[model samples]
Target chain A: MTKMHMVSALNNALDIAMKADDKIVILGEDVGVDGGVFRVTENLQKNYGEQRVIDTPLAEAGIVGCSIGMSLNGLKPIPEIQFSGFSYQAFHHIKQHMARIRQRTNNTMSCPMVLRAPCSGGIRALEHHSESPESFFIHCQGIRVIMPAGPYDAKGLMLAAIKSEDPVIFLEPKKIYRSFKEDVPEEAYEIELDKANVRKQGTDLTMISWGAMTRLCEETIEDLEKENISVEHIDLRTLWPLDINTLSNSVNKTKKCIIVQEATKSCSLSSEISAQINERCVLNLEAPIQRVTSWDLPFPQFALENYFLPNKTRIKNAVKKVLEF
Target chain B: MAQEQIGQFGINHVSILDKEGNVDEKLASGFTKEQLSEMYYYMNLLRKFDEKLFNLQRSGKIGTYAQTKGQEASEIGSGLALSENDWFVPSFRELGVYLTRKVPKNLLVQAWNGDTRALGNPNHSHNLPISIPIGSQCIHATGIAWASQIKQEKDVTIVYFGEGATSEGDFHEAMNFAGVFNLPIVFFCQRNGWSISTPTTKETKSETIAQKAIAYGFKGIQVDGNDVLAVNKVTTQAIEKARSGDGPTLIESITYRMGDHTTSDDSMKYRTQEEINEWENKDPVLRFEKYITNNNILNEQEKTDIHNAIEREIQEAVEQGLSVEKPNPEQMFEDVFAQMPEMLKEQKEELLNEIIQMSEQNNNGGNQ
Candidate 1:
């Protein structure tokens, strides 16, 4: 095992996959020569040559649409949309073709491609660079949506997403791209899709979150444990095809739950999780489920970003409310 | 400073066969009698199939279908130029291409009837399923060609779209990629005069759709879409150039939409009868039929036999399409993923149990 950050871990994942399969090709804006905007694909073009690692023109729809074509013709293409906010330009291709090709063709043609984008806020970057669009992709059918919080899970999930037969929307939280380091395995490994990780176990309250918010939840759980409140913290590594079984089991044991997310409160993944928990573990619940999320406005600019995002105070307050109820 | 011309480009228009069934003998000499007869047969077959589909929709046997009436030459000529190894990526209105590629007639019927099984296996046939969103398949064709280039394969990819597609950003992006990579692809554009209710003149003011390729650093040519010989000649030359690594070519075939945009449309509301009459005089199928007769490529007896055979084949296809069983509800859960996740499995099971419970309730009520 070696210590690495999220960017290095993701780059290692790409290197390993490309070395194992010649059919794997990476293409996007600035992916070659410059590695990537976040340098997640550094040294890939140098190692794989320009053919396998392409530097395409600045057209998101073309990048995604062409990748769909490449995947259709027997190549496993991983196309990166520069930012999650700009993915809307390619949303037509993603929602219409990439997600439905297999079902539309009755399994005759499947798109085994992965679309990578750096998502969520806290980077203090320009507008459109800090938006969380996981809920948009989770609502789409026939595609897997994944978001990995740390270096270890990033490498494992990236490899699994590359090997998956179905199309995957891999959302990398840019805020933590290089914020911290972890001892990740050197060899290839796969963390199964549609499975959540139990970061810490407790019997008092259950806190569910994903992406960068999971790190905040970890800190909050540390503080709560010191205050004599036991909390079960779960990181939803895969957003779609959710591991509801794990969630229900944890909620049943804790009997109080709080969902934290970076996206707006309306029609987000948190809403879905809250509704599912209410349906499945309502009888076991000791209090009403609380959701701590960003307000239902457009993601604010950098000045108000910290205020807009769910902070530790907000999460602890939600936890207190659920416990007291 | 003095002003000078930076670049000069010219677009060429090709028309070897005329409306009067006369051809420039030298330009048409490359085609054998068999090839000419085959092209004529496909054109006739497409027209017949188109009429039958119209009747089927009228009788409520199938859903709305986009007809391929006057553009038969544009579809069949370019389709026949392709080798089986080459890919045929098409927009929704190329039934003639499917016929040329030997896609089953029953599958075509089923596709129009909204059956999923009609998509067939694209890997086996080297043809993509019809794209409905308009102009999106061009980029796919470029990517396929790019893949072939990367693998150092000689296979070329040919993509078909309509005139209105030229106005789309995807079309321009596809052209740019083909130019930049020098990929082996042919952008076959059918200038079918109308995109639904809107005419081509309103879609773009570029004088001709073929010239758009010049900006992308490639050759663009306009062919009389009603002239099967000209379309065949240009497409053949374009495919050869692509195979030889000469890069992509854009061929604009000029034709008219002889029918409505689809069964759901009424062309009479927007188009004048006189304009329709003018195009009807230059019908592609009639022109090809006359050419075959004038050249002695097919005799009257042979023509009658071909028609009779086509009628029988259409009948069999209709029967086969109609006789297909309704798909099981559980089949919907399949193909969404390579492996059904536990969540989906539970949902499928719940749906099945719900169906069973409803049936059981009905049975108990009947006994009471």
Candidate 2:
């Protein structure tokens, strides 16, 4: 085991994948000599050469569109869009081509590419840097969307996404890229997608979240445990092919659910999860599925971001409402 | 260091054949009489196929179709320049390119009918499916060339798009990458004057689309797109340069959009008859046929035989395209992933159950 941060785990995964497969390539703006703006790709260009680890011009659409072409031509490209907000430039390629290529070409061709971007808020980043756009991708059919909350799952899920046949959107939580450390394995491994991780098991109420919000949910669960509130905390590692069976099972046991998300409340992944849980575990419900999420308004300036994002107090209140009901 | 004019860059316009069957013997030597005759045959065949598909759309047999009427030379000439091993990336309106690449005619028709199975490009064919969204395929072509370069392969990639695509950010980004990395690729821009309702003059104030490449650090050539010989000549040179590791070149074939953007659009709404009439006199196939007839390269009997054979072939292709069975509706949920995820599997089952119930109801009605 090696102690590493989320960025290091992702870099290590790329190194391992590139060394194993000659077809693997890495490209994005500032991904080469600058080693990405966050240095997540530091020293990779030197190791893999400039051809494989490319520093593209500042064009998100080109970076992604070219990567789709490379993927079509038997190259496993992991194109990085600098931020989730900036990924809108490539959304046309992502939705029109990357997600639909497999279905468009039938089983003849598949886009084995991973579009990596930093997502969610809390870093006090400038506009277009801190945004949780997972719902936009999760809503895109035929694309696998996965976000890792820590280093261990970061390496595993990164490897799994790189190795998947269809296109995968690997949204890395920028808030935790360097926030914490974990003992991640040096060897290559894969944590299966479409599976949820049970961070803590309880029976009073089920708290479901993913990405940065999972950390807040964990903290909220710990704080509520002091009041003998046995809140079950589930981190949904994969958002698209959601592990609803696990969520439904938890909801059946707890009889209540509260979804936490960093994105706006309308048509969010949280809304989908809540609807699914309602469909599966409505008879077992003790209260309505509450959502602790950001407001529907545009993400405000950095100073007001804390208020925009879901906090421990809001999550605790949601859990208390479900338990009290 | 004071900036001084160290060098001069000027765009060269190329045209090997005139509208009245006159040819430049010096530049026309590269093509054999037989090859020149074949180009005419293919160009005629493409027109016939396009006409048939337009009729099919009118009859509700297919969806919206993008016609490549006047721009045949720009598509076929550039497509024929690349070797078999090289890659071809096509925008939506490259019917001539698809024919030159030997993509099955039935599949092209099937694609217009909204069937995904029609896009099953043969294995190792190196031909990308038609990109409907304009300018997106340019970057794909650059990346394919970059991959071939990394693998030390001699293959060059050719990407096709219209003059209006130059306004897209993907085009600039692709050209910038090709210039900076020296990737082996060709950007074939058919400047067909109109992009839907907007004219090229409104799209960009630049005098020529070819000059856009100069800003990205490469050579750009303006070719008479209606002249098949000129399009083929420059494209061959560009492909050779790219394959030999000399980097990319942008060829802007100056043509006019003789047809509407697609079946759903009306050219009469945006363009003038005078402009269309001006381009009709410089028809690519007619010019090539004139040259062939003037040189006696293909005798009258041979020309008649080629036309008859192409008509027969088009008839067979139309039959095959119409006869192909429709794809199973359930196939939609099957290929979304390598393995259907649990959620999709449940949804598929739910759909299957509904389909079964509906079919059973139909069977009961038939019995009654």
Candidate 3:
């Protein structure tokens, strides 16, 4: 095992998948020569040649729609949409065709493809560059949503996404692309989707989050431990097909919980988790469920990005509020 | 600015048979009597199917249907040009193409009857299900061809859409990709004059839809859509060019929609009777029939026999479609995913239980 970043881990996963399966192809804008804007797919074109790693014209809907076609023709395509914000251009294909093809054809055909998009904030870029669009995809029934917080999870989840028989929206948090590193295995492995990983088991308040926010929650919990505060932390790997059983079990033990997310609080995945907990673990609660999330306002530019994101302080404040109650 | 011609592009329109049952002597030898007769037979079959399905919709036997009354030559000619290995990507109104491809007539009826099972992606067929959304299948055609090219497969892909579909962004995207990648695909746009109520002139200001391919850096040809021979000739060349790795080509078949956009639509609301009557004079089936008579390919007795045979086939297909069992309601919950998610599983169970309880209540009412 070697220390790797999220981008490299994802690249390795693509390489491994492509090597094992000749049908697997990678397509997106600037994904071949430029190796993507973030260089996550660096040198893939040279290694896999132009046919396997294609640099398609700048068209999100076309990229996705064509990927669905490739899937129907028995090719496993992993199409990247540049950024999560730009995926809106492909929402029609995603919602209408990609998500509906299997059910539309009634089991005879499946779009066994993966749509990879960089999601969420922190690296303050231009408008429409750093917004979390996971909430939009999580609402889609036929598509699976997989978001990874670190290198290990990113590699494993990406492999699983590529192998899945149904279409998957694999959202890689751009915030943590190079923020840290972990000793990820070089071999191909799969981390189960719809399962939560308990980062730190505590009997007190349960803190649940995923993607970039999960890392922030881990840091917040680490600092809280210095102050003699024990926090049960859970990283939700897959947002949809949510591990509600693990969530409610933890919520019941802690008797209080705080859900954190980088996306806006309105109609976010946090609201769904909060509601589920409220219904399933209602009698076990000692206080109302807390949601530490960004305000409903648009993601600000770099100058005021700290104000819009759910930082450690915000998460800690929610934890203290839940603990005091 | 001086009136200097910097560059020029030409659009060729081909027609082998004229309206008065006269064929160009030079092209007449290229087709045999049997092939010409087969074209007429398929054309007659498709028209009969169209008339039958429209009547079925009127009697509430089927859901809303899209009629291909006047565009038969464009669809059938292009479909016939394709080999069995080539993929046929279609928009909703390619009934003539499907019939020409020999897709089960009963399956078409079942699909129009709102049965999803009829549309299941059949491994045995080279055709995809009819796409209701406009212009989406264009991209799929490019991708399918690209995959075939990557695998070094010789099979070509032919995608059919109408003139209005060219307005969609997906069309431009697919065209650009096919041009850049040199994919083995054919973009067959039937310029049928109307996209629902909108005219072709309203769709674009360009002289012809065929010219749109020039901007994408590929060859585009225009054909007389009313002339089945012309459509077959152009499509055969385009398909051959793709199979030989010559890249993509766009063939714009100029035709007219003699029927309404669909059963629910009324052409009289948008077009004049004069225009409809003028187009009727150039009817593809009638022109082909005239050719068969003038060329002495089939006598009156043989023509009558072929017509009777087509009508019998249509009747049998309709009966077969109606006789099939209605799909199970629970199937709606399946096929969404390889493995149903917990949420869908719960909903499916809930629905099944509800159906059981309702049946028990009906039984109690029967006892009373």
Query: How many collisions per candidate?
Result: 0, 0, 0
Off by over 4 Å in 2: B1-7, B361-368
DockQ of each: 0.72, 0.71, 0.72
RMSD of 1: 1.7
- Candidate 1, residues B191-299, lDDT tens digits: the string is 9999998999899999999999999999999999999999989999999999999999999999988999999999999999999999999999888887889888899
Q: Tell me the spans in candidate 3 whose CA falls farther than 4 Å from its real position.
A: B1-5, B121-125, B365-368
Interface-residue RMSD per candidate? 1.3, 1.3, 1.3
- C-alpha RMSD by candidate, in order: 1.7, 1.9, 2.0
Whole-model alpha-carbon lDDT for candidate 3: 0.90
What would the TM-scores of all predictions be?
Answer: 0.98, 0.97, 0.97
What's the ranking of the predictions by lDDT, best on top?
1, 3, 2
Writing each residue's lDDT as its tens digit, candidate 3 over B17-107 gives 8877788888767888788888989989988899999999999999999999998888888888989889999999999988877788998
CA lDDT for candidate 2: 0.88
Model 1 C-alpha lDDT versus the unseen true structure: 0.92
In terms of lDDT, which candidate is strongest? 1
Q: Which ten residues in a row have the lowest lDDT in candidate 3 chain A?
A: A101-110
